[model samples]
Target: MNPTDAPFVPGVPAEHQPATGSAPGTPLALYFHHVHPDVRHYTALTPREFAEGMERVLAEFDPYRPDDLLAPSGPVRPDRPTVLVTFDDGYRDNLVHARPILRELGVRAVFFVCTGLLGQHSGQPREDYLTWDACDRLAEDGHLIAAHTRTHPHLDRLPPEQAQDEARASLADIAARYGPGPARLFAYPYGGIPAEPGLPGDVLAFGTVRSPAEPWHSAPQAIRRTYLPSGATGTWDGLVRHWRAQWQPAGATARPDDRDDLRGERP
Candidate 1:
């Protein structure tokens, strides 16, 4: 079976495993790309749709920032399960639309930026991406601004030296812009974990696992995140249809109007 398809077996090294009765609950990490009024990509979410999805997420899990896990003391054990919401490629709409909705909902998310691409416009207004000042404001707003390489290249395909520069320069750029603290967290561009491990040991890098509800063990250097779906399949209507099938009794037929979003409903 593919590693991405494999179940998340708990591999907490014996010495680091939680004490009896203090075992950690599953922590879901989700990554989104664009949040615009228009659906720019399948990963894009309109502001209204984004807000609704966040509400649904909150009903099931408490919010967590990336550093909450990267801290030396390990992640906090909240009363509920945790979810870390993150965005990649540093799109401008994240600050424009998503920020207001998240601010209203009291959730702080992580924004992984490519150092080289900031403020470079490609003629398309919406694709202008985030500026350095924008990223500074995001940091000031209490959102974690992390690294996503200097240029958004496939590290696995690049030459080793180039890969090293791409990975290292991103961290350096974050540190220079903000400070050393934010440099420790990273998300691989396009969810590709390079065959050559380019990042420093101290950096906690994240790649994505696409399947939902998979168990992701707490690996400090190699964290796994879920790709939050958007567009048609992201709406409540689309999700309810899929979830109803998953939650129904083994032989029970799902009714046509089994349309509940299942908020706060545990299976």
Candidate 2:
């Protein structure tokens, strides 16, 4: 079977439901780039490994609803641990592989897509990245579709007009292609969130990092996310061990002095 057409053996939800046993107090957002049967990028995780990671997460954390995070007036539930799974860069495998795992586990996730790059091939089969129809299917399936920028540019480095245009054009494109009710949630390209980050309009932007859900306390526009490390998917134990630390707060890692603009290897 083609990797994109891998069957969705939906895991048993009764067996994988989020346990009510976690001590609440923090929120975690996990961001992934790809999911394929075989490893490609260091960020790619196989379906089985992805499922294992989800199982480990379900065993401990409550699946935090994205609405609660996206809404400016949304409730911040710090009582018990909450988690939101997010996939960035509009990869096609996100719909093919990741969706089924989430569906079976009763997990709700946010998918950030680059509007300009959707429906285009990445030097190979067009299935390499998401298309408009696939994105629509995800929206229909109850997953959230948000913006990652129109061309996945380094927003901070662009001239002010171009930077704002990247932000504005993406939100407009997602609304035009998807639906039109503030598809304004965003993930900065390459996780570059300027220290003074804010779109001219209302938006909930995301930065790549591991931390407690303290975006509102600090930067409301740019939220923090825990990158799903490549090796964490090697085993269920690895998933549990690494992801658990990812759920809690930690000291900030070193950032480039020119942290305002981040460039990605692949747009």
Candidate 3:
């Protein structure tokens, strides 16, 4: 049988459910970064490993297109559960291994890139990062390409002016190369955020910490994310354990209608 057709085990709830009498539409968002099979070592995968990982994800959640979440005027569905897949650091492994699997599964995801790091020769031990041409292809294939800062700087540690520069410069770089502008979506390097009091309002920032039970919080432009690491036991019991530990409240049903708002909210 195909791995994609494997049965999924339901995980425990990851967030807080609404009060019994409360109205529906409570938001719940789950975010994922890299999706490799073997993360014990940061090595690129052979084609077979990538295929297995893609099968695991498709069996679990509904992957969404970046544009669908950023659309300005659409009747957002409030009941569907949304899982946003994101790749950090412009890894070439994403284009080589992850992209093809995603295409086979018909999943759409977002790729957060560091412009200065692309096309540069890196001695980082892993040739898993993406190339400029690969990035262009992913974008052309309808995947969302957003900013991860100019050089992957930790925004929280920088001075106010420097933080703003990092944020703006990354955005500008993406716009110059990819087209009009990165949709309001932005991911902070090392999951960092600005401490500056007057940060720009144009972009939306997504953080690294996230859960499944509650919807993400709104900001001038900020959203929280759940990290799905590689090597997580892909069993039904394992998934349930992760979900319950991460987001689900006791005795609560997740409403599908709430998922629309959850996805649209920043991050």
lDDT-based ranking: 1, 2, 3
Q: Write the per-residue lDDT of candidate 2 for residues 73-113, one digit (tens) a residue.
A: 43344444567788888988888788988899988888898
For each candidate in the order shown, give its overall lDDT on alpha carbons: 0.65, 0.63, 0.55
Per-residue error for 186 in candidate 1, Å, reads 0.6
Query: Which regions in candidate 2 have their CA more than 4 angstroms from the true location?
Result: 1-26, 70-72, 75-78, 122-127, 177-182, 195-198, 210-215, 232-267
Each model's TM-score, in the order given?
0.74, 0.73, 0.70
Candidate 3 per-residue lDDT over residues 103-153, each given as its tens digit = 887877788888778776544424346777888899888888888887887
- Candidate order (TM-score): 1, 2, 3
Candidate 3, position 207, lDDT? 60
Q: What is the lDDT of residue 184 in candidate 2?
A: 58
Tell me the lDDT of candidate 1.
Answer: 0.65
